[model samples]
Target: MAERLADWKQSLDVALFATRMNFRSHLVHPGEVVLANLGALVQAVSGAAVFMLALSTTGVVHGWTLAQWAVLTGFTTVARALWNTVFFGTLDIPDMVRSGELDHYLVRPANPLMLILFSKVDTDVWVEIVIGLGMMGVALQASGAEVGAAVLLFIPVALVGSALVFAAMHLAVTSLSFWLRYDAMLSMLVWRFDSFAQLPMSFYPKWVVAVFSTVVPFAFVGYYPCLYILGKTDSPFVWAFPLAGPLLLIPAVLLWRRGIARYSSTGS
Candidate 1:
């Protein structure tokens, strides 16, 4: 048993080492990193600017102050970072599957899924972290909701939950590549679904809210937990939302594994 545990630990270390090496290789291509960073910066800045403009026009919408609203925006931006970092293969899965690239991935010494997912780190995504946190700080000031150390305690939990939701959503989307040969429309569909996550779930109809909150649960990563942080929802559900994102991932992953089994390699 001890040998088995050691083997597992060694495998984990090798995975981590390989990931570090992949990141280092990208760093050598400074131009690509610069271009990617620029794009991410533009995305983060545009998002924050638009949210700030909306908040200014409304002053306070649905009892949420600008700071509170900004916190929601930050949460969504963080979700973007999580999505790109952990589940980006969703966008690339179809291409890999159709090109017989998946065969190579399957034969790799490391876990093929982990290697494919985390091998390419998006360096520019840090821009979102900077912009989002800056907006969150401004929102905190505007809302006069000085978060205590206790609030910081919830941050790690929220981050983990957000990651789980990202993985679940992206993996589910990518799993369709197993059977769907033409996936050119998949990216557009993902973007459309993600657009709903960018805004407060409260502004939508109750049924829409129910769809996201209970069915898909994207709300747990950004909207619902932020509502609690902003003191908007006093419901017990908000307090339990952080766990929802992670719990939902179990079924999603199982489905993804099943899909993998069904994957028929495209000889091309």
Candidate 2:
């Protein structure tokens, strides 16, 4: 227990250091942070505007009301903010592999994957985070849903789980860099799968829903969380999706380990 506690503390310290270093690096240019937040706010607004405008005209999207869609958008924007700021570093695996920069991480005392994933931070994503939560709160109020224990407990837990699921997914896909000489396009393609979660999964056919739920599992990121909050379905199964993140991480970590075993530095 002592050893595990110590390890957790060390990891936490490393994470903090990484975040500070990343901030310092970016802050070296005084206007960079401001520009980042401005750009991110515009991006967030554009996405919400597109959906809200359409919903105003149509009243609903494939059975999802405007307010319900806002909940999903909140979940997606926050999760995407997380993915962009943190897990997105997994996409760097290809560049690290090709340049043999991965070797530096491997030789470090810390876990290589943890080091890589936590090595940078995008501070600007706070804009998206704020917008996402604002949308959720305002929409929930308009929809007459109470922001009680469930909302306080569930949304955050769901977001953490959602982030983990995609982190593992990206790690697994980018691990392909160990075999392929160039994996940029493939990684980008997999990363784009988040767009599917920007709206309700009900809009798609059953097979597409099945694929996202299991094969790729991006559905857990937005659809299920919002479903529960919106009271759209009575199915108890919605509660189980958060567990899927850690479960899916099993195979993803296995693939990553295998890729590490097979890797040979370019110098080889």
Candidate 3:
């Protein structure tokens, strides 16, 4: 048990160190960082602005209230932002494959996937987390939901689960690049697919929900979890869904392993 605990600690330390290095690497341009972050703030605020303006009409969409929609927005925003900021680096597999850059990761002593995932960080987009949380807090207050330790805990847990779910989808799609080197258009669609997820799954048709629930599990990414967060539903699936998210990682990792084995490297 002690050895296992130490192993976990070591992994955590390495991950933290890699993330810090990646963060610093992106911060080298102070002027670029400032201007980019300002643009990010405007982008985030504009998205929220559009949502509020649209909802100002019906006061609801697909039977969810403004405040509930706010929670949903927050869930989607934070989860997507988290993935974009931290884990999206894994999507660079194709570029690495083409440029021979991935050899650096393969030569490292640490896990190649870890090196790839934490290999990059976006300092400019980091503020999206704050914006998302602000949306949630304001929406929760407007809805009169109790703000306490439990809610606080659930929000972070939900955010992590949601982000992982999205990342799993991304990783699985990205792995395809190793096999389908010429299919850039298809892979590009993977990230854009999140636009469908921003709204509650209820807004979509039955088939859409079915695919999201079973295949990609985008429902668990934000929809059902948002329901639980807002006290709207008590389905055991809502609670179990997020916990089961990492299960998707099993297949994603398998794909990564196979893809790496298949990788011919630019030198070859």
- Model 3's lDDT to the true fold? 0.80
Candidate 2 residue 142 Cα shift, in angstroms, is 2.0
Cα lDDT tens digits, model 2, 1-268, are 9987887677767766876897789889969789878988998899889878878988866887888788888887887787777776788999999998989888866667777778877778899889998998888888766667866787788887787778778888898888887787888898777778876888999999999888788888888887777777657776677787778788888888898898888894
Sliding window of 10 residues with minimal summed lDDT for model 2: 143-152
For every model in order, what is the number of clashing pairs? Answer: 1, 0, 0
Error of 1 at 248 (Å): 1.6
Please list the Cα RMSD from the true structure of every candidate, rounded to 1 decimal place.
2.4, 2.1, 2.6
Q: Which residue runs of candidate 2 sit more than 4 Å off their true CA positions?
A: 1-12
Which structure is stronger by TM-score: 2 or 3? 2
If ranked by TM-score, best first, what sequence of candidates would result? 2, 3, 1
Show pairs that collide, candidate 1.
67-139
Ten contiguous residues with the weakest lDDT in model 3 = 236-245
Clashing pairs in 3: none
lDDT of 3 at 89: 87
The deviation in Å at residue 265 for candidate 2 is 0.6
